[model samples]
Target: MKRALYQRLTELYNAYVDTFREADGKLPPMMELKRIHTAHVVANARLIAEGEGFDAETTHACDAAALLHDTGRYEQLKRYNTFRDADSVDHAVFSHDIVKEKGWLDGDPHRESILAAVLYHNRRDLPDGLDALTLAAAQTVRDADKLDIFRVLEHQITTTDWRHNSQAFWNLPTTARPNPVVLDDIRSGRPVAYQDIRSLADFVLIQVGWIRNGLAYATTRRLCAERGHLAFRRDFLHQLTDDPAVDELCQYAELPTQGVS
Candidate 1:
């Protein structure tokens, strides 16, 4: 995980994605979006690692993990023409397999940890009993991933018609009422389960749920706040529907998350 090694991985990542872009006249819009997202996630990972004062080796390892975390996405789109895991494969696991098959992590001291982090990055909850370094690496990428996702999700919600981006919105109704289970999860301070979300309004609330309870580091939370991600979410939610639950969840979203203030 030295500086030179990290540079090598960066090159490898870019070249890997470039193959897909080169084959087509231009990358598909969704593919291009993921390419951009991988870069931003890497940047966000570095921000969190440095903000948390990770040592050089650990920080470099984290950055490598971030860069390779989405390795399977290109192939996923090619094979299934959709990003939905329920319809195809778990992209995280698919990413993990690609990393392994390519031997991309070979010779890196933190290779296994990075693989573990990639595999678990999209899980509903990380399993308990992971080693400390592995846990930190996983949590760093997960938070980093979410930090950028707020930006991506906000852009998609605000700029485009959700009707056309059904895959991104779980093909749920754009104006349907939030699911009762989703509302309960918010009121009770639990992460919103993807299975419970039945509408775009519910989908937006899932992001707020991330604000209230999902981010893993205070620095990540601060970055989220500084970016006004949560504020935009609040505005977006009201547009979807007027409900007392939105008001309640908004209050919790404002309360300072526990940990380094």
Candidate 2:
């Protein structure tokens, strides 16, 4: 019964995504990002449920929660370019509102919990009173989200398109010097300030920094290892150990793997 409803919700979500893409005409780069994120969330939820011994039915609910976790982010990004919860409005709150307004999670036993998870997924901390099921689902989704972000940044850096150039995507300043806080965060294993990033290189370093702290699941860590983020960590080691500024980043195409563990 619940599984069927989750399927319907997924179908609707995909339709909404398609419509959003068509209406926008030439989807933004982040659209690919959202798709990738949703996929990872779903996969991560499946892994978590399987490892935790969830039955087939229970696993389906976790998967549904993961799929819908970021549905609000699509609409939020459509209206605002930045993903910063503070710079614009909080995407999580907006996501909760959008899900309810659209009836995206209606009529499912897991609906309220899923909505709650989505609302707080990107938040600095989780709220109180979440039962074990909902809490696990939300944690899976968050870990999956961060894991994929690491993959995205690793891809961007390896491909040398860190600049995010062209009109379709925002021309992120990728060539500017790194900020002191950015370096400090990299060394201390903390979340980087989005505003402190001066160039694409710094942004890449910041993305890698997240793995050290925000990630929660072993599966996420395994996936990140497979993607070769450890190699990326090497650059941070050099930056923190030898030169904080990483003078002449152009000379180094790939970072060494020192700060990853």
Candidate 3:
């Protein structure tokens, strides 16, 4: 039963992406980035579900949530030309509205749980009163999203012509000094807001900080350890600044040590 649902959800996701193609039948560069990111999130979600031993039905619901989690990005970019929620709209809310309007999960028995997971996946803090299943699904989506984000940031920071894909850089200046406020947020273990990011370094620091706060699943931590994501960030920050404080902050993230295949 859940397998059938997964198939339908994949079809819906493909159809949705098709609507966003440019006049030449290609996605705009940023839109293309989002398209690929969504695919990775779906794959990561499946992996997380399997790693954590979720039941078949719950796993399928998570797969659905992951596939549709960022559906708002296409419309948000088209309408506002920005992915920063503070500059435009709360993408999680927008994504929820899109899924609800499309009636994507209209008749599924797990519809509300799926929708609730999608709605809160991007939140800094999950709301109170979510049932155990709903909370687990939401956390799975969140971990999947963050895992892909680490990949995105790694590419963005390394590529020479990243400027050509300015939206991926969030249009921030590529200066070396991290914003003090942003650094403080990381050091003090507080959630960093998008609006507070004043430079590219601040953005990178925020990503590193997310290692400490953004994670929700043990599977995610294991994957990060296996992927060497934690090591990559630590080294990336060391290259960015020789400050001992930054090293301490990176150490505080406490990512796993085992290598993932």
Per-residue lDDT tens digits for candidate 3, residues 184-218, read 99887788877788766677788777777667777
Q: Report how far off residue 102 is in candidate 3 (Å).
A: 1.1
The digit string of per-residue lDDT tens for model 1 on 26-145 reads 788889989889989999999999899988877877898899888899999999998888899999999999989888788888888899999999998899998877888899999999
Arranged by lDDT, best first: 1, 3, 2
Worst 10 residues of 2 by lDDT: 250-259
Better of 1 and 3 by TM-score: 1
**Number of backbone collisions per candidate, in order?**
0, 7, 2
| Candidate 1, poorest ten consecutive residues by summed lDDT | 252-261
Instruction: Point to the candidate with the largest TM-score.
Output: 1
lDDT of 2 by residue, 91-157 (tens): 7777678778888777777777777777778876787788877777777777767766666655654
Give the per-residue Cα lDDT of candidate 3 at 191. Answer: 85
Per-model TM-score, in order, reads 0.92, 0.73, 0.89
Comparing 1 with 2 on lDDT, the higher-scoring candidate is 1
Task: Name the top lDDT candidate.
Answer: 1
Model 1 residue 19 CA deviation (Å) reads: 2.1
Q: How does model 2 score by TM-score? A: 0.73
Q: What is the C-alpha lDDT of each candidate?
A: 0.86, 0.65, 0.83
